[model samples]
Target chain A: METTHRSVVDAQDTFTMAREQALIEAAQAGDKQAYRQLYDRYVGRVHALSYRLTADQGLAEDATQEVFIQLWRKLDNYNAKSKFSTWLHSVTANITVSYMRKQRGWVHRMFNIEGSAAEHHTAEGSAGDVDLEAYIVRLPERARMVFVLHAIEGYRHEEIANMLNMAVGSSKAQFHRAKHLLKEWMGYTDE
Target chain B: MSKFEQQLNQQLHDLAKEKAPQRDLWRGIELGIEHQHDTGTVPQNRHRRLAAVAASVALVVSLSWYGIQQTSVPATDHPTGQALVKALSNQHEQQKQALLVQYTDAPAMTENWEAQLAELDEAASAIKAALKEDPNNGALLRMLQQVHQQQITLIERVHAPQWQQI
Candidate 1:
């Protein structure tokens, strides 16, 4: 029975892959309707990823828009060597990072103003609902980015270092800092 | 992992599954794509205008060439319109070559942009060969000018600063 179920699952996966490949081809051929169908399919996940990375609802929305626009422009670059969803995730991650960098001006970066700003913003948004996501948003900028990319997105420290242009050790350290802060906020002890 | 860590991980997984943007984001994405599409056409429209201008110049030059031939005028009576067309074509060629040299090491956005440029060059060469056979062929002259315009546009587009960003 287990073997039969596995085969059936494999067949469904193949069918879904074939359907997505056709959609990608049609979208690449300037079919806006086909592209819209793709948007409907991926928008929720993409928006969630963007929100986690940027930790701001407004910025996440902007990043989501930028991601789709970049995707449309670079559709022909997709070679299908990997799953379409994987490629889309990589694209979204890169665009979100770049968008965050652009939004964080030199003054904000130099002064490290985003932590307080993000905390205040999150507090305002999460009036009665204090959640893990709200705490994640209150993390310092670099720590938040490292946590999201590494912990949430499943990227290794080496990959995060390259993506963020930081040393691998720094990526590890930031992730540790993120965890320590989260634990402290949640009142978790070593015991 | 500790129990706390496991709890945190599960919470994150649940958050990913349950969270979504408050608004329908497709509308913003559609607007952004439309804006990008509009900006993207600026280069093509510029190419069309260039081709139109080149055709006008070709038409005037061809008319002068025909007039001189019909009147049976002396060679020195008017400046050679053929020489003028050749000079204009040479001028465009020189500009295109300069652009090529300027962007020799610059990366192109599209993988097949060079192939597209080569195809335009081949079309221009074919038209030039036909023009040589019938020196005063007005249609061939116009086509050659249009092809030259296309070549300039292609080279400029592939080497555009924005392409490097892409």
Candidate 2:
């Protein structure tokens, strides 16, 4: 019975993939409706990642809007070598980083300035906000970028290092620092 | 890591990756997508119009200038030489006016495009003055013709989406 259920799920997955490929091709051909469908499908994921990385609602919205705009122009660059979601998530991360850099401006980026651990995170009184996500965003700026890209987004430390322009050791250190801070913020006291 | 700490790590991995924003972001994205589609050129049509205009101008400049060179005619001394300069200058004026009219309904790509045009006009005027004195010089005539092309090219180039963004 389990095997039969797996076959059905596999068939459904194939259908979804075929449909998504068609949508992508249509979008590449400049079909706005197809592009709109792609936007609808990916906007939530893009906004989620943007919010986590920037830790500011307003910046997240601006970033989300910019991501889709960029995606529309860049659709022709997307190939089938990777899953569409994977490619898009990578694009979203890169664009959000660029958007954040623009918001921070070149001066801050040159000086490697970042906010404190407690800056820009909302109070936890709001309903339906995930505790872990809230805590992750509260991590210091570089640490949050390193953690979100490495841990949650499944980027290797080396790749994170390249993306963030940090040394490999710095990326690993930031990831560990982010993990330690998250543990403390979550009240995990075990050795 | 302890068992509870391991659970915390697992929880981090288990967090849902999708969270719809409190606002409807698609509208903004859709508007953005539309705006991009407008500014961006379609691949097949990329620069086709500008290329056609430039090629036509080149053909006209080369052929007309060749006719003058064949006679080895001094421009101020020969009617054809003087006429050739007038013809080329008229063509340049027409191309510039055409480009300006084409983009007249649209916003100017830069505030100084007109000022830039005036500067080019000054350059063309100086070239014409030199041509009046050294009318038989092929290089001077060539320079005059090329400057006319430059004015047309500048109008089209700046009006295209290729403007330097702030």
Candidate 3:
């Protein structure tokens, strides 16, 4: 009975993959409706990724828009060597990082408004619940990025280093720093 | 992983999976796609139009000077030199305009491409002003052609498909 159920699940997975493939091909051919379908399916995951990296609602929205625009422009170059979702995630990561770098210009720093909300919330510890999202966003910029990419996104430290243009040791150290802070925030005691 | 680390990882994984933005982002995404399709090439077209007008004016001025040079001097003195220069300049202008159109919406690899292009334009202008004063100065004319070629080459190299790959 369990094997039979597993086979049914496998069949459903195959069907979903086939549907996505068709949608990708249609979207690549300039079908707006097809592209919209793709966007509807992926926007949540993409936005979530952007939010975690950026730690700001507005920046996430901007990055999400920029990512989709870039995806549409570069869709023709998406060969099917890897899964479409994997390629899409890679593109999202690159664009969101680039967006963050652009937003960190001297003007933003001069105003002392770079990621200020997260810094303020983290400092005040005013979050009512031990919310992981709240804690994740409160992490220092480099540590937050390293933690999200390494812990949440499942990227290797080396890969995170390359993505963020830092040394691998720095990525590992930042991950540890992020882990330490989250533990401290959540009141986790070492046994 | 330790028990504490495992718990942390589990919580993070759940958060990553379950969290969604507060708003429906699809509306924004749809609008963005529509905007890209509707007016993606408008800026490039505008730039090309401006370039064409400028090139036309430059061509008229240069050709008038070429005509004057042709009649005032002996044919064998420069022997199609003015015509050759005019043809090369016209060709360079067209190629530059085509490149401007091709890279109309290409994301610049570097932040200072505009500044660099402006500097090249300034250099070209200075050379052109000198050429206006000494149209028969072969060295000044050669410098102007080189500057123009540099501008096209710089624009093309920065916006090439290979840069996008990098």
Interface RMSD of each: 12.4, 13.5, 12.8
Give TM-scores for every candidate, taking all chains together and pairing residue i with residue i.
0.59, 0.61, 0.60
DockQ in order: 0.18, 0.24, 0.16
- The candidate that wins on lDDT is 2
Q: Sorted on lDDT, highest at the top, how do the candidates line up?
A: 2, 1, 3
B53-127 in candidate 2: lDDT tens per residue? Answer: 766776666566655655665533446556767877887788778778998776656677667667668767876
What are the clashing pairs of model 1?
none
Output candidate 3 Cα RMSD.
19.4
Could you tell which candidate, 1 or 3, scores higher by DockQ?
A: 1
Q: Rank the candidates by DockQ, best first.
A: 2, 1, 3
Give per-candidate clash totals. 0, 0, 0
lDDT of 1 by residue, A63-164 (tens): 787788779989999999988888888898999998878655543656567554443332232212337887887888889989988988889999999999
User: How high is the DockQ of candidate 2?
Assistant: 0.24
Which structure among the candidates has the greatest TM-score? 2
Query: Model 2, range A70-148, lDDT digits (tens) per residue?
Result: 8888888999999999999999999999888865654355556675647444444322223787787788888889999
Cα lDDT of model 3 by residue, A108-139, tens digit: 55556534344344343322345788788888
Score residue A35 of candidate 3 by CA lDDT.
87
Kindly indicate the candidate among 1 and 3 with the higher lDDT.
1
Q: Evaluated with DockQ, which candidate comes out highest? A: 2
Error of 3 at A185 (Å): 0.6
> Candidate 2 has which clashing residue pairs, if any?
none
